[model samples]
Each structure stands twice: as C-alpha cells, then as structure tokens.
Target: MILRTFGWSFAITALGLLAAFLYEGTTALGLVAVLAILEISLSFDNAVVNAKVLERMSAFWQRIFLTVGIAIAVFGMRLVFPLAIVAITANMSPFEALDLALNDQEKYAHALESAYPMIAAFGGMFLLMLFLDFVFEEHEYEWLAWLERPLARIGKLNQLSVVIAGGALAIAGGFFADDPGDVMIAGVLGMVTYILVNGLGDLFEGAGDVDEDSEDVKRGPNGLAVATGKAAFFLFLYLEVLDASFSFDGVIGAFAISTNLIIIALGLGIGAMYIRSLTVFLVRKGTLHEYVYLEHGAMWAIGALAFCMLVSIGHHVPEWITGGLGAGLIIAAFLSSVVRNRNEDGKNQSSADKELHSSGV
Candidate 1:
C-alpha cells in the first residue's frame, strides 16, 4: 500500500526531471533532485505531524490531499508565493520580480535573505500557535448547558492567550524592526493576520461534535459524521498551510543557490516529491506512534525551524549545520526511544515468564 501510494509520486518526480533535463539541462535536473531530497529531509516531521491530523480526516479529503493539494503546494506555494513575496517586498512588479529572480540571481537572493526574518517571524508564530493549540486546547465540544459553561471558560481563556500573544508579538516587532516604521507595520500586520485566521479556524471548529475520547459534548446531531467531516477539512487545510510555511524557507533559500525558474522549480519539485513520498510512507507504516518521542523530536525540529528562521533573518547559519542539527536531534530521539523500548520489552518478558512458571507444575 505504501509503495503503491508513493509509486505515482516517484514516477511524476522522474518525469519532472526528464522534462527539466530536456528543456533546461543536466544541472537543472540535478539541482531539482537535490532540492527535492533536502525538502523531504527537512519535512519528515511535517509528514508525521500531518499523519496525526490525517488519521482524523475522512477518506475523501485524503484523496483531495493526494491530488489537488499537492499541486497547490508544488506550484502555488513554492513557485508563485515566493515570487509574490519578492514582488511585494522589493517594490517591483511581479514580472519584474520574476525577471530579477531569473536574471539577477545574486540581487534576488540578497533581497530574499533580507526578508527572511519577517517571513520567519510570521511562519514561526503561526506554527508555534498551531502546536500549542493542538497540544493544550480542550478538544471536547459538547453543547450541554453544564458542559458549555466550563468549556466556555476554557475557550475564553484560550482566546485571551491569543490576545496576549498578539500583544507580545507586536512588542517584539519593535525589537526586530530594522526600520522602526516598517517593523511596526509588519508586526501589527502579523498580529492581526494571526488573530483573524486562527480565530476563524476555531469558529468553524465549534460546529463539530466532541471527539470520542474527549469530555466535551457533540454539537451536531450526527456527531461522528460531523466530526469526521470537520476533521478532514481541517486536516487538509493544515497540510496546505504547513507545506506553504516550509516552502517559504526553501523558496527564499533556493535563490541563494540559483535564479533560473526552471532550476528552482526542478530542485524544489524534486524536494517536494520526496517530502510527499516520505510523509505517505511514514503514515502507512505508523512510524510516528511507534517511535515514541519522534513527535517530540519533530517538535524540537519545529523549534529549530523557528530558530533557523530567526537566525537566517539577520545571522548566517550554514545550511549544512542547520540541516545537520535537526537531523541529529531526530536520530538521537530515535535511539533513545529504541533503548527505552528494549528495556520495557525485557521487563514485560520477565513478568510473563515468571507468571507462567508460577502457574505450572
């Protein structure tokens, strides 16, 4: 099943390379493959994180994710969004931005590098909020009067947290503002955008029923169906957002290496394919749950991702070191989990053998 799902991704990736080579050349094709792998490696956690969301989704949305969703991620987020950012930040027309990106790779790269902090700040806040909400927010959504009261209290508090965070972010924006005026504006925009977008996500969530294991009541008549539908939709949305967030980094960084749109597309395309394939593979194999703290490792990776963005915005972190550190954290987490599991198995086996001997003649 894993192979079958990934097979198409592999094929399309190969075809993409073939097309790139035919049209662009060996260098373009090679760069695409490398970028694809880099993207996949960096995004392993994304897949695991996504699987947790995906498992809650209905089959229908999953189908959409594997199809239309990938295209949005590949073309829209990776290709278009970067150009859009370039255009907006540099005060150039979109075509002009594209021309600069393709023709003046060095200048384009410098522009992107300069903008890294702002993008990082935005992406980091958004992702951190997502992680927090998922980890701590009450998932129960029952509408009973007694249930609603306590739930309302918690919900209001969570909203308050958002307000507090927004305020804090606005303050930090002052610190990060290279130009006080521009920084203040970017910061405010970031805060307001985060509030509006996340609030809407929460509002839609209210229409659904309570999760089965959660204490909250189901709001809908067909609780299970509503929950499933909502979960699917949100899961799909989450994947798109996560893909876009990661793409911001790659798209920005890719300019540092090459300006050719085809080359950029090829490299990023290859990287994206690997990420998709690996995500599917990990999900099908249930690697996330099996690895115990791998998700924690991924969370740590997210933290690193946040730090990398912040550093990249102003400071230079060698790509090799940045990527290596994340890779190392994951490997260490895996090894620790393996050791812990082995110790657990030993204890269980001993208990079983003793029980059997004690029962026998």
Candidate 2:
C-alpha cells in the first residue's frame, strides 16, 4: 500500500533533486532537500485534515484533487501566487514581478515581505475559522471532553464562530498590524471566503435529503454522504483555499533559506506532492475511521498554527516552534487512539471469558 500510494511522490522527489543538482550543484540539491523536509514537517497535519475532507468527495473529484489540484498547489501557490503578491503590493506588472523574482531576488523577497501582514492576516483568520468551527461542532467522540464539550455547547449559538473570529481579527489588527485598515480588510475577506465556500458546499450538498438507495449517492469512509456535482465543486474550492492558507507561511519562510524561486518551487512542489498522496492514502485506507482522534489533533494543530501566524505579525515565531507543536499534537493523538483501541480489545477479551464461564464452555 505504501509503495502504491507514494510511488509517484518518490519518482518526483528523485527527479526534482536531480534537476536541482544539475542546475546549481550540490548546495542547491541540499537546500531543496531541506526545504522539502521542512514543508512535510510543517504540513503533515494538513494531510490529516485534508483526508477528512477528501473522503467526502467522490472518486472522480478525488482524482481531480490528485491531478488538477496538485498543479494548483505546486505551481499556482508555490510559484505564481508569490509573484502575484509581489506585483500587487509593489505596484508592478506581472512581467516585472517575474523579472524581479528571477534576477533581483533580494528586492523580490523584500516586496513579498512587505505584503506579509495581509498574507498572515488572511491566512491566519481563515485557519482560525476552520479550527473554531471544528472544535465548536458537536461530535460523537471527544478527545478533550472538558474543553471541547464546553466549546460545543457555546457553538450552539448562531454564528458564534464568526463572532469569535471577528473579535480575534479586530484584536490582531488593532494591536499587531502596522496598517490596521489593510489587515482588517484582508482578514474579513478571509472570513468571508471560508463562510461562502463552506456554507455553499454544505447548502448544495444538503439541498435535499440524501437517498441511500440511489446509485449516485454513496457513503464516505467516515460515514458521511459523499459530495458530488455542484457540491463537490464548492468543496474543491474550499480545499484549494485551505491549501493556500497552509502554504502562506511556508512560501514566505522559504525566502529565509533561499532567495532563488526555482529551488524553492522545486522543493516545496515535491513536498506538496507527498502531502496530496498522503491525503489520498488515508482516505483509501480508512485510516480516519480507525484513528478517530486524528482529525481532532489535526484541528488543534491548525488552531496552534493560526495563533502562531497571527502572533507572527508582531513577533518572530520560529518555524521549528510551529512545526514542532503541530507534529507533537498529531503524535499525541495517534498514541491516544492506540491506547483506546487496546482498551477496547481487552474489554472484549474479558467479556468473552465471562461468557465462556457462564455458559460452561
């Protein structure tokens, strides 16, 4: 299963490394490798969260995510998006931005840095909304009952997530952001994007009662109704936006490692491929069903990341800190799931023994 799922990622990684070596010798090859590992570490939880969403998409849409979605993630977000940001913020044409990226990389990095507030504000708020909604929604299983139960109760209030997120945005803008107006606008847009995309997807998916017996209708691995047609399209949009949000920090942070855009793209692109493959692998293997708390952990990691992004506007938060926190949460959740499964197995064994004794077997 591992080979079947990750075979393409391995091929791409090898090819990408070879190309990097050919382009700029051993140093470039090493940097590309490091950047790729950095991306994977920072975004592993993203893969888990993505699996939760991807499982609900139909097979055709899932294929779209692996194929078309990958292109958008790799080239669109890793390469073009940064250039577009530089262009817009620096008040230059696209060609000029491209030249700046390829030639005057130091100046290009500075331009990208100038746009950091807006980037962080938008991505941070969007991620905060995702984490807020997840924790607030009632679920069958609770990893941290003391905290999640209370949050879930409060979540019953209409638009409470939005209210909380709005308050956070206001605080971030007023205190942390240099240009409060731009930060506020960008943050609001992020919130709105989440609402529109998530709301529309849910609206379309639940437009009518699902008929289990219908040929088109199917249950996902997690037992949710699979989204199809228009609903799937909206969901696809949500996924892309979510990916972009996750990419913001990585893209900006990569500048610290290498000003060369090509090396950054090659490395981050390779990591993106692995992430996509891992998402699909989880869905196909029904890993979420077995490790129920994994989603909870991933969401919490997202919340931590959101906080880091927002705080980073005023303070320099190390990438290792952000990556470590996320990795730790995911690992803890996986361990908790293992313990829960073992307990259940022991209980079943004890019950079987009792039954045998009672029946004089």
Per-residue lDDT over 1-361 for candidate 2, one digit per residue giving the tens place of the 0 to 100 score: 8987788789989999999999999999999999999899999999999998888889889989988998999999999999999999999999999999999999999999899989999999999999999998999999999999999999999989899999999999999988999999999999999998889877766762365554444676557788777778888899999999999989988999999999999999999999999999999999898998999999999999999999887777889999999999999999998999999899999999999999999
| Candidate 1: clashing pairs of residues | 32-266, 32-267, 36-270, 36-271, 142-216, 142-217
| TM-score of candidate 1 to 2 decimals | 0.80
Each prediction's TM-score against the native?
Answer: 0.80, 0.96
Error of 2 at 328 (Å): 0.8
Q: What is the C-alpha RMSD of each candidate to the true structure, in Å?
A: 6.8, 1.5
Worst window of 10 by summed lDDT in candidate 1: 215-224
Candidate of highest lDDT: 2
Candidate 1 regions exceeding 4 Å error are 131-176, 180-207, 211-230
Tens-digit lDDT string for candidate 1 (223-255): 333224554465566678777666666776666
- Segments in model 2 whose C-alpha atoms lie over 4 Å from true places: 208-216, 219-224
Per-residue error (Å), model 1, residue 92: 2.9
